[model samples]
Target: MASFVFKVIRNAFGIAEHVAPGLCGRAAFELFCRTPNPRSLTAGEQRAVDQAARFMAEARRHCLTTRKGRITVFDFKPQGGTRPLGTILVLHGWRSRTEYMKSVIEGFRDAGYRVVSLDLPGHGQSSGRRLNMALAVDAVRVAGEWFGPFAAVAGHSFGGAVAVNAAVGAVAGIPPLATARLVLISAPSSMPAIFEDFGRFLNLGPRSQLAVAAEVERVTGRRLEDFVGSVQLATVPIPALVIHAPDDREVSADDAKAFARAGDHVRLFWARGLGHRRILFDPEVVSEAVGFVTARPRLARVN
Candidate 1:
């Protein structure tokens, strides 16, 4: 099959690249910064992406240009003459496009909230091929300005990390973006942890890891700790729901625990069997997110 051959070729190349240990570190760093399989949608998947993009575009749509590239945004106002509670911004994770978040989008729509989902730069239909936490945060801020007054933001995986940064940054009065609620699904607590894991997975040496770290710092202008979602959550006063599955193969469930421990305003929920990607599609998970975003507070607390 085509997929099998592709995997074989990729694996062979990977083995050859790692065989020479001296050059392996540098090679690993290159791989670390690059977005592997930049285009992964099959014919059917591509069609789905096209359909979703078209649906979102039927509403108000525009491309916001950033320093790095232009970000495609879809903004849908609420229907049926019922004033929208507020708009909810949804962000997808690494190597994922907004189309993959159909469940979340529909969930918010059914709950009478306007939804805005953008293809982060370097993913989906957006421009660029490399991604870093710092660039992603900047792109979100730009998008927030164009699509002002978000009631809440929900993100999965890497996007969840960005959502945390956006929320905390807004709380800190950086760029003046405001959101009343935050939801993080299967998000990594620490970027450094992910970097180290990637290094081990690729069999990179300590020197290579250091090189990768330096390269990341150079690109993002911030240390790995500065990007950790848990660290940002500690200062975020908005209500947050951290959802994770025990069977998730990528980010650990402990990251959700860290989010919960950061503040009483944050809550942790466990969903079984959804793994990493499916959690975004699970109806129950989407319902929980919708509820959190729309819920009336029992008491008002000043930030």
Candidate 2:
């Protein structure tokens, strides 16, 4: 049933491409930016969420005002009211909420660092129905201003791309996020590659693809090529840890290698069997990220 519906939509876009490419482009871009509804959590994920609930209950929640809308933010400090080493801002991927990242958040909390996280513009408790990397970056910038100068910023999947862009400061109006370290897990390195994949999925022709690209530029006020993760990461001064599984089906491990090759400051970690989403829950992955975030500057530089 779902396949049939997708085929019908694809054919509609194909026909519309020849009839009214501009209108089709606008509609396609809208679908492209729309956030997917949340899925049922796996048992393991549910268990993690259940365990983190108590920690979340203790967190100080804030509703942050942003250009997109109000975003829900969670500020979790170290247990026992002790002083934190530093704050770590967390961002979840598309279709995921802050709660889905409970395992990672708990790891950070246990490591004695303050953890601040938010639902991207259209996901979780945040407002708006549509989301794009540009809007996500804006939200991060706003959050940085409010609870920033973070010791590190950690993100997964699309959120990882946001972390890179927020750190790169390439967009026209949005300033670079002030952070000392970065963690990008299962992130795509090329924005153009993402668009290409989308175009292939919709069976879009050359004209329709160009039209969609134009719409993206019109909406974001920047060319799609300008947002390549590797390109941006090369210019960022902070050290970054790139984590991805070699067998990840959603995002290529090649992207991770691209990030590592971009600069000496970047370190790549390969999680053998964790795949895309599971990588976030693995104990070793969590430990590696937390350790990287909490490592001393001299030790980090030496590594």
Candidate 3:
């Protein structure tokens, strides 16, 4: 009876944590970005924007053999003579390809960091036929090696969860733990809640959601609950920037509050207007992220 009561309470809390209203506008915003402007901009302006997008999409499609097997990685390096501020390893969200993170790479490039990213095993150019949360975590673990010690990590949505996993050293085989800074953009802290959300997206009732979740876990050998990638912000000594927008329709804005509860080393940046996908390119966010990572510590004496 005690176990039953605890399970009930746990399930209720999980539901309330990551899922909520405001999802429509988030969906609408994503739709709008893909809607296309249909207006003529200057040739130079269009070329720069489209080329940056192309660099992210086309430049890194080759497969590399890793311990986990042949995995797909999309690596973007800065132009010659562009000294790297640091290395950045990007992880893509569920069902999204590495191309989706072009804005993320763009921000790091502007900061002069070489961005190395992968299509998280089951998505994009990866070889897997099925996408699972654990594979995303696995991709982060193996891919971190390529970025080496001098690196910062960031991700979006499911990818952000993987970043959190990588930062906290939960995903095996990554290194320089306790030293690497982490950036989580619109990350969800709970996994079961997201599955519950997959049901809501289809308007399925409680029973069907639970049933489908169980079946998925059994067939894939990966339980979404088991792969819940929320980082223990309190345990980490490294500085972390957690960014989320309340206007976000995908992941709840309340997650920002949960992250703030992690500890003093964690900084929460909440902006309005930018949706989940487009938030990667928001100029204000780019500035904030660069500033946070590059800022000299208060203890450092200025020359």
Candidate 4:
């Protein structure tokens, strides 16, 4: 019943978008950025967002207002430890919050690293209902300022794209955020691929797709191609690990390969049956990612 209602709403909005690409495109774009119910949860689809929220309270919570919008952060410091070995910031994917990343967060915490995760603007407990890649990058920058000098940063899906942008300073007029290492899991390689996927999902005609792209460019003051992870990786010299499964249907495995191939400093890891989101919960993948982020560098710091 709920699924039927959602499809109906989707088709209605899609029709509106098809008829008037200018006005409707802007309105639908806002709705497109609106947070959605977590579609496929591991435990069960019946689990509520409130349940996830309650579970996430295991960590200290903070609310930060950035130039884009307010975002919620979950900070998990190593318990019963004198000093943290290092700090790692986790960025959740579109429509996902810190809670959904419990496995990764717990893995880092158990490894004696302080873990911090944030609910990007328009998602989770963050403020605002509209979001864009530019604003998402801003949220990352703001969070980095608040809890910074991170040894590493990790992100999944859409957040992975933003993390790359943040690291590379791809967003116009913003300086790059520094970090020792980066982990991108199941991320899109290019903004064009994402826009194409969005257009297919909306059943947008070619002309409507172009119109929507123009509107996005107008709003962000950035050419969409400039935000592609593969393109941005060329400017980033940091060590990185890119994880992707062959069966990831949302973002192709080719996307991960493209980003990884862009830089010799980047490494690719394959998690065979985990698919997309499930890879986050796989014990082996979790351990490997934690290990990468927490490993000490053999060389001394420059400064």
Model 1 C-alpha lDDT per residue in residues 1-303, reported as the tens digit of each score: 987875664564456554654355555656765664548767877787777776566556678887778888777766565788788988999878888888888888888988898888788767788666656777888878877678888899988988887776622224535888888889888878888888766645666566677666666666555767776777766788888898999888888778778888888778789999889879888888887777842222222
Model 3 error, position 10 (Å): 23
Q: Where in model 2 is the C-alpha error above 4 Å?
A: 38-51, 296-303
lDDT of 3 by residue, 1-303 (tens): 987875664464345334632343233223212312223335754554466664765454557664444678776776554978777777767646666677777777777887787876545556655444445555665665555553677778877776775566553344423336777788887766766665554444454455555554553364546544433667666677777887898888777667667777777787568888778878777666666677632221111
**Model 4 lDDT per residue over 1-303, tens place:** 988887876686577665776765666566666666434444553364555665576788899988867888888887556478888989988867777788888888888888889988877778887677878888888888988878888999998888888888877767788788888888887987777777776666666676777776776677766767876786767888888888998888888778777767777888777788899889888877877776632221111
> What are the lDDT scores of the predictions, listed in order?
0.75, 0.85, 0.62, 0.78
Candidate 2, 1-303: lDDT as tens digits: 999999999999889889988887788788889886434566765676677777678889889888867788998988667899899999999778898888888888888889999988877778877898778988898889989999999999999998998898856688889999999989989988998898888878778888888887886678878889888888776899988898999999889888888888898888888899989889888888988887732222212
Off by over 4 Å in 4: 1-20, 37-55, 296-303
lDDT of 4: 0.78
**RMSD in Å for model 3:** 10.9
Return the lDDT, model 4, position 199.
Answer: 71
* Candidate that beats the other on lDDT, 1 or 4, i.e. the better one: 4
> Residue pairs in steric clash, candidate 3?
none
lDDT, ranked from best to worst? 2, 4, 1, 3
Candidates in order, TM-scores: namely 0.82, 0.92, 0.68, 0.85
Separate clash counts for every candidate: 0, 0, 0, 0
